[model samples]
Target: MDEVLARQAFDTALDEHRPEFGTFFLARLLGLKISYPDETCVIEFPVRDFLFNPQGSLHGGVIATVMDISMGHLLRHAYGGAGATLEMKLQYLSALKTGSATCIAKFLRRGRSIAFLESRLNDANGNLSAVATSTWKCSPSADPTDGKRVP
Candidate 1:
């Protein structure tokens, strides 16, 4: 592993993490660049060796986390509230060894209190790597602008 890059990633996460938008710790650690293009939430990130599994591929858990964040960010952006993931399922279609990957999350259905969302992760070459579908419980009382969890 590249110790310098790993340390930089850790330092960046510590220095830049916030509760709002795309500034979360995990996002920083993964060097994720998040954006809203049209109605979808997109996250592009580098594939670091530190995040690789024993077999030398990007770890499945890391992929799943990015997929989850994409959906959650979409919920927060579109609804002005945060969401609690009730359940999520993922399918890994391929392994990513190098280059960056982009995960795009979109809503399948949005309701008053519940939502269905899906995220697709593709390699930099535009090959599909994984897909995730999830159900979320919207916290209607949370305010998106303030980035505070309502409880």
Candidate 2:
């Protein structure tokens, strides 16, 4: 994909469709920023009470969700339009406290139909909080004028 188009897509998604709940609750709650440079994708989220676990630490599920969203967002920016996750695996490495966190995801492979990505979440102090890998399947081509995918 062209670098300029990819960046434009990323910016558009953040401005228009980011802070997406259900899929990106933590990213919305924390005001995450997604960026792409070359093959790498980076997502940063601020820490807050809504994302805390019972013990007052950042929730593991929230961390995983951010990582997953980052991966999916990367694929969407790279491919254009939408893509669905086919599979994902998450590994939690450490506890995260209330602060800023950043998740970096990279494209491992990409095919016509599927894309593979790896993501890692880091706490404000730069400690590894979680790691995840995801596969996304692209949707079929959309009609040019209406911008809706044909069935």
Candidate 3:
């Protein structure tokens, strides 16, 4: 992939395709910060008290959200289209607590109508706490302005 093209795609994803993302309730809840100009999309969030479970560990749902966003954003930025999750599977290997967490997402393959993606969440200590794999159904036709995300 060309650097210029990747940068342009990243800008489009952040600025043009889903401008409403800034106001998305979940986004604000997680305080997601995005960084991607390459094949992988990286999302980070500071673990807040409200996100903790009774065990004082990060909730699985929150971790899953990060994984989903990471892969979804990767699909959008890499292919210039939005994708819907058809199926998802997650595996939790450890509990995450303290500091921050980051999710690294990448596409394994993209076919005509389906895409396979995976993500890994690393705790503040850089230990892998969870992993997720998903299949997204890509649209056959996309809006010229917003790509494949259907409203």
Candidate 4:
């Protein structure tokens, strides 16, 4: 699809699904399906031409964005608020040629003002393709530390 149509579709979805869109409009554009269960956040999406590099592989930025979103999603679920990425490191083990893939994020630690999370991205065949670790500082708007003491 062209950029105009893509933007229009994104606008339509945003209008229909307001206030609870996961991550951002790009995820919606990229067709990311997000799920939460127990202590993990999972996102599955297809690798499309728009998200590919010149070499015909999934872009590194796309992988990083999914990883980052997974971590942020986990922090929001566990802490009741989204977070800002203070830092993150990613390792791209292999290239994804095509098809859908999955990203699973789990919390390493949830602190008063910061959270640590890790995400693993698996290819369409369910083989590990990339991994990332990130630290996020709880945003003021979503901070769970408003005079509430941690147990």
Candidate 5:
């Protein structure tokens, strides 16, 4: 598929699946906007009390989750079907204290059965907060049970 169509399908699926964690949850709960700009997926989460850590900074797990989601979304967009993460590693570089943060994910490589991706999270001041890389196992487009594409 072309980039535009692929992005449309990916975003549509995201809305349908409503992935329960990370920016998906934050977007739904706080009305944050998620978009694909160029090769990267951008997510903006408004800093709120619910997302704060005990030390008054955003949780590292939260930053990791957003980056993971962004990576997964990019994989789906590029590969055109369901993909499950086989492994992931995240590195926290700095603390995310307040304001909004953005995640930029890029496709490193893709095969028929696997895809590798990397992403970085930056705070409002454009400082890098974390970086992550993930590998996903790409499943066939056809459903195993019904032999139809998953809708």
Candidate 6:
């Protein structure tokens, strides 16, 4: 592992940490760059050695987290509120060992009290590495004072 790079990542996350939107700590730690285009949410991050598993590939948990973030952020961007993930299912198709990965999310369905979303993770070369679908319990909005979901 590149200790200097890892330390720099940690410092950046600590410095840029925020309680709202895309500036959450984990997102910062992973150096996630989030964007919304039309009706979809996209997140891109580097595949670093510090994020790797013993097998020298990005960890499955990290992949799942990125997918989850994409879907959750999509809900927040489309609607006027954030949502709690009630459940999520993921499938890993390819191993990512280098370059960057991008996750794109879109809503499958949206309702007053429930939402369904899907996210696809692709490697730098545009290979589909993983996919995730999730269900969320909707919230009315976020409390600006504390960044908590308001119902």
- Give lDDT per model, in order: 0.91, 0.71, 0.76, 0.82, 0.69, 0.89
Q: How well is each residue in 31-129 modelled by candidate 2, as lDDT tens digits?
A: 678788876778887776555788888878778777877887777776665778889998888888667999998887766676778999888989888
Q: What is the lDDT of candidate 3?
A: 0.76
- TM-scores, all candidates, are 0.91, 0.73, 0.77, 0.82, 0.73, 0.91
The digit string of per-residue lDDT tens for model 5 on 1-151 reads 1356435544654675465433454445543456778866677765554556788777777777677778877666655566898999999898877678888888776666766788988888999888999988876772222432322
Window of ten residues with lowest summed lDDT in model 5: 142-151
lDDT of 1 by residue, 60-98 (tens): 999999999999999998888788999999999999999
Give RMSD to native, each candidate. Answer: 5.2, 11.0, 10.9, 3.7, 11.0, 5.4
TM-score: which is higher, 2 or 4?
A: 4
lDDT of 6 at 141: 68
Pairs that clash in candidate 1: none
Model 2 regions lying over 4 Å from their true place: 1-27, 142-151
CA lDDT, candidate 4, residue 123: 87
In model 6, the runs with Cα more than 4 Å from the true position are 142-151
Please provide, for model 3 over 34-138, each residue's C-alpha lDDT reduced to its tens digit, 9 standing for 90 to 100: 888567888888876567788888888888888988888887776567779999999999998778988999877767677889999998889999999999987
Using TM-score as the measure, name the better of candidate 4 and candidate 5: 4
Error of 4 at 101 (Å): 0.6
Model 3 segments more than 4 A misplaced? 1-19, 142-151
Ranking by lDDT: 1, 6, 4, 3, 2, 5
Give one digit per residue, the lDDT tens place, for model 6 in 63-138: 9999999998988887678789999999999999999999999877777677888999999999999989999987
